[model samples]
Target: MENWEAGWDDGEVGESSFDYSNHTKSQFLDDVERRLKLFMVRCVKVCRTLPGSYDGQHFGQQLIRSSSSAAANFRAVRRGRSQKEYFAKLSVTIEELDESLFWLETLVSTDLMPEHRLADLIDEGYQLLKILSKSRKTASD
Candidate 1:
């Protein structure tokens, strides 16, 4: 079995306690990595749908850069050897996620993409912003 699944035999995921705080370190890391991957995929798909014009190309590249950084910087967060370092790297994810939301809003405003196309992604970015913000607050507290 994969590393994240290896601890299932220990009742790591019983129904009584199914929250993220209950997970092992590896499981948590894997969860973050999985989320980043999925977010990046969403970015790629949305960027590809942009119209073939100057604004489309500009926002597409901006979206790709921010979304990709959010995921890639997560790896850096995982590598952090100290609380300060971790928070520093994690902050990058927070900023990039927010930047992504801005770009998505821009696309919708310009009528370059339909609102339905970005609704889920917009919501996800908002959710992630809340999550990451809470995490950083907790870390420093």
Candidate 2:
């Protein structure tokens, strides 16, 4: 038996077990979820420091939606029943990730967020985009 299969419950083994490397997928998704949560936390911190004004509200909402959507769409992609569905869901994930990055850039450029503080989260967002793009391409083929 494979090293991975050795730890599994005998009764739980099935075709799906062989079809997907759950360990790998779970690890990747966990990383994605972690980054998304971190992004949201940073957004909240920046938003709190901003003046009570319309710009703050608008920017906060955009950041909240995009950051949250990344994880939501990633979950949807994992649950997809077909390759087509998976790619479609991943496309949304990519879009949301990009949108989050855009908002982060805007925040920095507009001086709402410090560039030094936003650097790490922005890097994470770019990495996620690269990962999602690769996944989407693979699913499409």
Candidate 3:
């Protein structure tokens, strides 16, 4: 049997059996979930520090929606039934990540968030964008 098949149990395989770079569904989803969680945490921290005015509330809501929706759509991708479905759902995630990066830039540029303070969150969004972009490109090819 193949090395991976050796680790299979009943029908599912355990995480310890393989490296994340193996591109197994569970590991990939787990990594993306962790990334989204970190992004959401940073967003909340910055949002809490924003001025409690109309602009803050509006932009804060947008950021929250985009970040959270990307996380949610990844869940759909995890359950995707076909290559077409996976590509479609993953595209949504990439779009949301794109929006999240835009909001991050806007927050810093508009002085709603300090660039120094928000650097990690903004950087994480950009990094995720590149990773997901590659995933989409590979899926299409």
Candidate 4:
């Protein structure tokens, strides 16, 4: 049996017993999801403050959809019934994460957003993408 199954049989299923450190996989995904939801709310607040410019409107729409989609797709992945479906949903989650990153970059680069404020969100997006990509590969295998 694998390490996880072995641990399960030994009744070592608690958080302290699970060795998530030194591994990219994390229980932190729950925290990330929570933060992402808050970040999306902030994005919506920022978007609401923008003037009626074409670029601003367009980017605001993209940012809102993509940011929310990341969380939505992740929740879907969690509910997936099979490994294949899980991987597929994770792939979608990755796409949404990427799109969200792109919108953030565009906002910063185009001077629509302050770089300092965008930095944290951008870093979080990158970290989430890395985690989700690893998850997808592992699930697919």
lDDT tens readout by residue for model 2, 13-115? 3222222245565665665556566766776676667656777678878887887887788778768887678778878888988998898898888787789
| lDDT score at residue 92, model 3, on the 0-100 scale | 99
Candidate 4 residue 35 C-alpha distance from true site, Å:
3.4
Candidate 1 residues 1-141, lDDT tens each?
222232232333233322564678777677767777688889889999888899999999999999899989888877888878988998888899889889999999999999998887787676556656666766766
Q: Which wins on TM-score, candidate 1 or candidate 2?
A: 1
Which stretches in model 2 have alpha-carbon errors above 4 Å? Answer: 1-23
- Cα lDDT for residue 92, model 1? 88
lDDT of 4 by residue, 100-137 (tens): 89988999899888899777667766665655565565
Best by TM-score: 1
Maximum-lDDT candidate: 1
Question: What is the Å distance of residue 106 in model 1 from its true position?
Answer: 1.0
| Residue clash pairs of candidate 3 | none
Ranking according to lDDT, highest score first: 1, 3, 4, 2
Which 10-residue window in model 3 sums to the lowest lDDT?
2-11
Q: List the global CA lDDT of all models.
A: 0.75, 0.67, 0.71, 0.67
Residue-level lDDT of model 3, residues 13-95, one tens digit each, is 22222234456656566776777777877776777778888988889889888988888887787788988998899899889
Span of ten consecutive residues with least summed lDDT in model 4: 2-11
Clash totals in order:
0, 0, 0, 0
**Per-residue lDDT for 139 in model 2?**
57
RMSD of 2: 9.4
